[model samples]
Target: MRGLREWWRDLTDLVLPAECGGCGRGRTVLCPRCRTALSGAAPCRARPVPEPPGLPVVHAAARYADEVRAALLAHKERGVLALTAPLGVALAGAVRAGLREARWGPGDAGAVRARGPVLLVPVPSAPRAVRTRGHDPARRIALAAAGELRRTGTSARVLAVLRQRHAVADQSELGARQRLRNLAGALAVAPGGDRLLCGGGPVVLVDDLMTTGASLTEAARALRAARAGAKSAVYPSSAGEGREERKAGPRMAGPNEGGGVIREAICAAVVAASPDSFEINRN
Candidate 1:
């Protein structure tokens, strides 16, 4: 069944041909100009207004505009699977920036060396959306991003451990606050999924784009709750600090302890972020 579907998709692409997802140019999956635009000048911090309580700091490769916006929509909505490689490369750039920000310091040799097998957790797509698209776009991009990371000497791997606890209304027509309300309490870590996060390298939440950041906020909430539960079993004292950190707002991982592990997310990275979410560094 899967093979036939793959064959059919290939046939369709061949028959209709394709244009660059970014520019709509003829006979190319993505043109060079659009590809460069997708990569951005550099990954930079982005935050949504009234950011959700557990939302971690996020980095984005490019602003969601023009070529970047078109490329993302084409891959996500139009099923341009070939664009995943370039999208993943863009995502990898953001991930590297997130990792750099999470580092305690350049001198922390142990933390630097111990950062291995980092987990790339992609946000779960709704089952209905997955069925309609005939593919899980976020997970595919994450897999490609992981490959890109590994090739660049970071031990990264995609771990799709998040699952939707209930159905959500389509977010197309919703405003920011409405989106948050609709997604609240809608995601959770899969059963026994906490084990993957325990004592492993930092887990970075990943997605193709960030709008209101409600989705990533909800995802971090689920992971942090699970991490607190897991930490109580190992480092009971740190549990209080974890809760405190949540109250303070989004935080990246701090210095590592001798035996205790900081299980919270280091940060988040995405291929693109809404233009309004860009934070100018004034200092």
Candidate 2:
């Protein structure tokens, strides 16, 4: 049934053809030229930008201008589902780099087990936006990144832990400060977030873009809060269980476990970012 559905969609697509998303060339998902532009080196962290307290360190894939911005908007806003694959590839590259940074001091085999798992938690979009887009874009990208990580033998998982606690005004028209204000009380960890973190792993925040980084900051705060709750739950239980606790419980913990230590450890990656679009006076 699914095969037939896909075949029918393909046939329909062929009949009323659309141009390539990356290049606007007739009858293709992406043209060679744009693909060439996109198929460059892996993305890295940009210079630090101030974010809300305890926000994670962020890395972006490409400057959100020219071809990159166009490609991102084309896939995100338009019904360009095919773009997700390549975009996911780009995102996966950043995830790999972030994971490497997180896991760098690791040892092999038994020693590696001491470090625990890596969790990728994506910033949540508004419910209305998800409904209108017909997909959760960040989650979709995170899943792809997780798949990529698993392929490379990293135990990565996606935890959609962040949720909107309040409705935020539209961010498009807001300046940086306005964006931060709009999102001030807008996000919280989902229920069961504590258990999710307690079970195992450090958390990495994921987002599609970072302008003022207000959204990512909120998400990081939520994840850190979850990690703290997770650690507190473990201690008394671990003490109560005594020596037996070591056998059954998760060995490693999330970022907030040690010294209320958030690990400076927070890392993030995106497919693109606003290119010097932020004005100092706009602050």
Model 2: lowest-lDDT 10 consecutive positions: 104-113
Clashes of 2: 0
Per-model TM-score, in order, reads 0.84, 0.77
Per lDDT, the best of the predicted structures is 1
lDDT of 1: 0.81
- Which digits, one per residue and each the tens of the lDDT, describe model 1 over residues 65-179? 9989998988888888889999999998898888777772233425744865778899989999999998988899999999998887777888798999999999989888898
Residue 140 accuracy (lDDT) in model 2? 84
Give the runs in model 1 whose Cα sits over 4 Å from its true position: 1-17, 104-112, 235-250, 253-264
**TM-score (C-alpha) between model 1 and the true structure:** 0.84
Candidate 2, residue 124: how far the Cα is off, in Å: 0.9
| Maximum-TM-score candidate | 1
